[model samples]
Target: MPKWRIGYRTLKTAIGAALSIFIAQLLQLDFYVSAGIITVLCISVTKKESVRASWERILACLVGLIYGSIVYELIGYHPISIALLFLLFIPTAVAIGAKRGVVTSVVIMLHLYTIEGVNVEVLINEILLIIIGVGVALIMNMYMPSNEKDLTWKQVRLEDCFRSIWKEFASYLRFGDNSWDGKEIADAAAFIEEGKEMALKNVDNHFLRNDDYFYHYFKMREKQFAVIKSILPFISTLDRTLIQGEKMASFMEELSQAVSPGNTSAYFLVRLNELRNELQQMELPQTREEFEVRSSLFYILHELEEYLLTKKKFKPDPKRTKTVSAKRLNRDHEQRDTK
Candidate 1:
């Protein structure tokens, strides 16, 4: 048996539907049950979506009423006339971007069909049902739970995964062997995809302002993760340990520590450029194996530079990032050389 639990949407839909029926019956409206059905259709995951759906349904129902009045009055309320009305109304609904409202409109049209005539009082009754149903939906949708904490937690998990991936890369390059099971790469990929989808849902929930920071952040990480994947094959091919690999491992360790939400890529880019300079000044390769390993290491460095550049483009908040001084960079470079 499937696990069963009441979700927020389920609870909201049940309450909204009941409230709509109660209000419509209290007003002594015709077909009060239609109000409840409309509420069920109009409720959505976000306030903006619910309101938009309700508006489309209400507009479609009004259009249905107008079409039904003219068609039934002329076509004599026959079965063929209902069919004819649908053929004409469905296309009109699609043209007006109200295709989602077609079912609700059909319900209203059927109500007119049952009555066999349209009048001011009857039209008002149908309109009241629409109002009650849509009003209840909008009211119920006002209580969206905050997902900021959830988003933050996912962000932390994603960053931790990235940190672990880079730490493994460093360990492999330095020791040429490590017992890392390589699970972090898979975990990071999952987190990036899941985080992106949740961020998009968050954007939909916000009607006034765009909360797209997490979305952009995840996208940046996704690109960086791809680069990491490409770098991995090259890392695995290294059979000969070189001194440059040790320096590159140290750089990877620094990068792993900086896997965060802040835009510290500029600082790392500076260190990267210095490392490139240092590499170019080093003695030429004396053997084929040494040459291959050095070239692969350079390719990995190039991809890492691209990864940093991708993050730089995102430009996360300056307040969240630490400032790196020229003196500090020089001192770090000198210390690495002494090692």
Candidate 2:
């Protein structure tokens, strides 16, 4: 859900509580008693930890009430003495950290000492009202529970990683630029790490309902990531070869077309398999010369073949050109233009 909607719901619940208290006051009920009930009900209906909060509030108020009664009996009826008694519980209230508990305790103590009736009837009413508030809170919470469910953390992490992989592969296919954006790669890597962590969290050490789907998705994603990771350095080499007037234009044209789904060459899968195998053994080239020489049309063909075979091994067509001479013609045209 949108954050704004969540905020609005919280606001609405608080307003509803205030309105309920107002209505209760109009019916000649004690405002403090009504306010306590409204507060508990509001928290119960709107908050994530409503039941726990209500329980804590009830416990804190009970403690405060006991403390207040003890102080009232010991300190007698001096205004200053009652005030001091109330002040003594402030530290305990602060420790408990319940707004309702502190307010209710202070109000009840003030009413007990200052009000004309210093009997057990007032204390009983106060306790009964607090109990009613808690009961109302529990009843409301049972009827309107929080709208959240337990999700398998492992499945979620795996799904996230798979989505990242899909995006990365799609981006690479569209751009023909093998170089991955560091940020995007980092995000995908993080998701993969999170998935690993979630995998460790499994008690039964088994796949859940969505786990199999995620596993298949993860495998596809890993394959795509590997292809891009291998091809990035070779892409720069191909560009350099074009700059050096290398005549592999037809070969590149065939490879580029094969990379596209429509009009894909019959030998495309075979060539991709060869490419994949070569990449598995290939070391990272430190020099530009190594990059260019090691990633020539012949090497690329082998790498492409291996890549395809990893998915599925297939036959290569003999008619496919290993190299093309269009770059030579392009270089001649450039020379003529320079002259």
Candidate 3:
């Protein structure tokens, strides 16, 4: 069973609709109820989307009014004229990237149809309705709830998944334990997708600046995850009894513990280079099986290096960190005061 809950968006939509209707009614506009419907349609998940949708609707409504008026007057203001009006209106709206506003514009066209023709008073009333409805939606969308906390939580979860995956890799290398169902890989991928989406929404919320640090961070993790997945087949093909596997397992365990929102890749890279050097200096394999296992281990190391290099180019967004810290401090203060 599913539960129904009123989220912030739903609340905003309700308030925006009511406010639009109230303003339209207060202004004595005809078809005031249509303003509420427009508000409902205009409210969007993100501020950017809301602004774009409002623009599209406004532009489409204008086009519909002009076109519908000409068509209605020329074609006798009959049902056939309306069909003719819509036949071109839809495609014209789409061409102008105002498809979202087609329905709203249709409402205006109907108002014109109801009045039998266009007039200054009715035109003003419809324009006022558009302005009031879209304005209310924009105002309601202005207070988009911050996604910083959600993004931060996702970042933490993604890092934890990475750590778990690395530990699983280490366990497999050290004990030949293939018991890990590789769930962390899937979980990390899901987290990265969710985080990227939320980060994009966060960026959309900020009009004056780019909040794309979290987005970049998630992208970096995505690259590293791909590398990790490539290393899996190599790991599974390895001979558990190989001495080289132990050293790689130890390195992976250390690397797993060091996963954080900081640049420690350089240290790991140095250690990895040293491990490669030590492997190069060792005695050559005595048989084909040993050579094959060593080759797979080498490939695993190469993939691990690629994984760290992906993170090497990434630097945490300091401004985002500070903003999040400030928000947390304010929240803490509020909690203390309430207590």
Report the C-alpha lDDT of model 2 over 1-339, residue by residue, as the tens digit. Answer: 755456543554555455545544554444345554435443533223455566656666666667767777777767865677767776776777665456656655666666534457666656655555555454444433222111133333333443344444434333444565556456555555554443332211232332232333334435644654565454444543332212233333444333311124347664445445554476777888766665554465555445544434222222221211233345558989999
lDDT of 1 at 246: 79
**Among all candidates shown, the one with the greatest TM-score:** 3
lDDT of each: 0.86, 0.48, 0.88
lDDT of 3 by residue, 246-296 (tens): 888899999998887777899999999988998898889899987888788
Clashing residue pairs for model 3: none
Model 2, position 183: C-alpha lDDT score: 62
lDDT of 1 at 280: 90
Q: What does candidate 2 score on TM? A: 0.43
Cα error, candidate 2, residue 208 (Å): 21
* lDDT sort, best first: 3, 1, 2
lDDT of 1: 0.86
* lDDT tens digits, residue span 110-155, model 1: 9999999899999999999999998999999988887765666677
- Quick one: best lDDT, which candidate? 3
- Segments of candidate 2 deviating more than 4 angstroms: 1-42, 45-48, 76-87, 93-100, 113-118, 145-165, 168-170, 173-278, 283-339
For each candidate in turn, the TM-score is 0.88, 0.43, 0.92
Clashes in predicted model 2: 25
